[model samples]
Target: MLKRIISGLVGFILLLTIVIKGGMALSISVLLLSLLGLYEFNSAVSKNGIKYVSIISYTFPFLLFLMFNIRGLGLNIQIILFIYILSILSILVLKKDLLLNDISVTLFSLLYIPFLLFHITLLDGNKLIWLVFITAFGTDTFAYFTGILFGKRKLCPELSPKKTIEGSIGGILGSLLLSLLFLKIFNIEHYVQLGILSIICSIMAQIGDLAASKIKRISNIKDYGNIMPGHGGVLDRFDSILFTAPIVYYYITYLL
Candidate 1:
């Protein structure tokens, strides 16, 4: 418990620093995290003893960052789509020993970790980015305590035995409360819209947590990495954010 609290505090400080010092600071931070997450994911997948190439895994994240930052170059959606198709075909042809499963999981990791997380950089100047953190980490914090206090029935016994229905409800309520506080602090006056978004983010955050757990179960590993004393790794810590950020981004972008 002490280890968890210490690690959470240190992480919060670092995240607050990067978020407050947005721009290249935020970009670099996201890049480093994406890279580390990719590394952890690749390591986890490799535990299944599947042989595959990681060249694209390493290279495409930079390309994704570039694609987002270099807006004036007129990089259209079609071009990005073509690049993905070409990359997949190249992998299928060149990597003879690699099977369909290898290509699928590797590509999925690319899209999952770095690709989805790159949205944070896109939200560099927006205060709503904080909502991403609040929904993700806040849910996690509340769920942990709630589970310890009143966790009775298992939420998903196979994926994660520790999770409970009570904990999940606590997480949602906690996320909604924190989100409302953020909205009030920021003086944003869209209670109806933001309220809906908070609920959606909370539910999605839990799904994201479950999804990460499923990955670990399939990989037959304990944690993604041991970077944090109690939290496991960047991916483990930010899995909820990865799922929630994109949702919040699009919500604020189109809906609100």
Candidate 2:
């Protein structure tokens, strides 16, 4: 318990620093996270005795990191993905050992970890960027305390036994409070819009947690990795952010 709290605080400090640094620093941090996350994902899959094109999974993010850091790189996604898919298929054709499931898992890993996580960079580090963390952390922290205080019914026994319906609602309330407070502090308008956004984001955060939990259940593991002592891995810690980042990004981009 002590270790978890300490680690969480340390991580928050580092995250604040990165967010403040913004620009290239944030980009590089996200890239490195994607790389490490891919490693963890590939390892988890391999534990199930499944094979995949691990190199390509690693390579694309590295290239993306390059593209992000370097201006005028001229490397487009269509071309990169075209060649990547072709390479994976060619390997599948040539290598009797590699199967379709191999490539499928590989592709899924890329999308799940790096692709979704990239939205943090796409967030572009403005006042709104803080909303992603607020939604994720607010829901998580409040759900935990709320569940402890007033949890009676189970939410999803199959995936997470401790999560209760009451707790889920608590999560939303927590997020709403935080979101409104942020609006107050930032002097941002649109109270109704932010309220709705908080609800949607809170639900997304829980979904993201369940998604990661589902993968862990399938992988037959308790935690994803021991990278963060009590917190498990990068995925364990940031799973909610993975879902919320994109939602916030697209919502602010198109809807708001």
Best by TM-score: 2
> How many backbone clashes can be found in candidate 2?
0
Model 1, range 146-194, lDDT digits (tens) per residue?
9999999999999999999999999999999999999998898898898
* RMSD values, in order shown: 1.4, 1.2
By summed lDDT, the worst window of 10 consecutive residues in model 2 runs over: 62-71
C-alpha lDDT values of all predictions: 0.87, 0.88
List ranges where model 1 is wrong by over 4 Å: 76-78
Q: Give Cα distance to truth, residue 215, candidate 2, Å.
A: 0.7
Clashing pairs in 1: none
Error of 1 at 58 (Å): 0.9
Clashes by residue pair, model 2: none
Please state the error at residue 205 of candidate 2 in Å.
1.0
Name model 2 segments beyond 4 Å from true. Answer: none
